[model samples]
Target: MSAARRRGSPAAGLCPAAIDRVRIRCPQDVRRAAEALHAIAMDHGMRAAPAHNIADKHTPVDAEGNNLAREVFGWSDRKAWCGNSRIALDSPITAACRFESEPFWVNAQGFRTSLPNHYLAAIDLANFEARAMTRAAIVVPVHLPFGQIGAVSFNPLDPALTELDDLFALQGDAFGVYARTFVASYEHVMGSLQALTAAARLSKREVECLRWAAIGKTDVEIGMILNRSRATVRFHVYNASVKLNAVNRSQTVFKAAQLGYISLAS
Candidate 1:
């Protein structure tokens, strides 16, 4: 769906005007724009390319991680032009990365807030601490219905490049447009998987349990507070977890918070 153009993006940091002037474009329009981003990055002595992802909170990684149109810039591979990451499926996978334990889910940047903004991942950086990859990385999170959250990854293949979200955010809107069109065209490929969110109607008990979980309450605590048995609380949590397609409590909490089922900070 074409979202109505907004006048501003959240907290436009360094290049507010540039981001505001940015517009959306399809694969055709991107032919020129992608070149411009690459050229601009190179002019600054950097390399960069665009990546697109679909909005399915099911996995944090882009099911189609890389955007080949980006090859025009300088990237070497297109296998990722359409790839997937397990982020949504398991972002801070229990053992893959050493993420500090937080009671609930976090945005891409690892913040416990659901404010309308985007997130970036450091892992996408080319070679941080001896990692063999590109130099710079930019990530943008797009929220869609049914708990679908997709994003774009722009990583300049330069092995010496270094920048933060601010640099790439300059083309925030442009990248946003490019990603939208890419997904729209590729939506057919993504197909209609089952919705991974709350049911058509969440039960009052489910809301109560979710609200309690938002506050970091365990089943025992919630049961005590609601005058029910721990098993009852467990039942509610299990039901909600299944509905969100979450395998564990933390994931359920995170997905629920992501969907506004509960306030992350509250």
Candidate 2:
């Protein structure tokens, strides 16, 4: 284990006071929590942005989509691509999402020379975006056991402000801890809030179709199970997808489960 792990999570005690002041029951609460995290990241001389895989799913396609997962909270000055760019497929932020543990940093030049070759291409892609944003970033991946995954990115306004070495030397452990705790709390409370609010947006039939779809039922199969016409089942599923702003069957199932309209569990 790294010293950070041996020493225990530094983020554990960093934000309790600020987090205690916010309620995660509403969108406003989420925003406030984000602000608190940003403030914490700033202590290390970098601005903070939070990105979520709101669907609670992560795949290359998920990052490649028009929306890079979802932008639950972010810095106003952050590059549009940082939150909504399809180019994220090759970005280091997406790469961080795949790490079992440990944080990753990417700068205008590239990822640290120590990163293995398999991780280089993604970091190369991230370097292009980093240059565009005039910043270098480090991401703290947040992987919750219940299928929620996300990250908090800390970026310096100017790539030259400090070397990646200094940033990591000074605040690496704090970044990991804060990102993990914040993302977990956000998902737990937001999951409940979405369950209540999102249900009202989906009709009973829509929910039924989505639940079935989540379990690997094809449209025709779903129709057969529900004794409805295939076209009818497709219609309900399409409507649910549209309501959730989902782009495909996989995303549709993911959104349904995230909002608590369906469960993909055994």
Q: Which stretches of candidate 2 lie over 4 Å from their true place?
A: 1-28, 54-74, 112-127, 130-134, 192-266
- List runs of model 1 lying over 4 Å from the truth: 1-50, 53-74, 78-172, 184-192, 195-199
TM-score of each: 0.46, 0.52
User: What's the lDDT for all of these models?
Assistant: 0.46, 0.60
Candidate 1 to truth, TM: 0.46
Question: Across residues 1-266, which tens digit of lDDT does each residue of candidate 1 receive?
Answer: 01122324553322433332222333244344445444544554444433333323221112334343434554434333233343333333221113211111222233221222232233342223223132334434444454444444555455444534344434444444544444333342443665663244457898799899888888899999999999999999898888878899888788777777677784
> Across residues 131-214, which tens digit of lDDT does each residue of candidate 2 receive?
335356776777664356676677785656645765664566667766766666666655434322433488999999988888
**How far off is residue 88 in model 2, in Å?**
3.6
Residue pairs with backbone atoms closer than 3 Å in model 2 (clashes): none
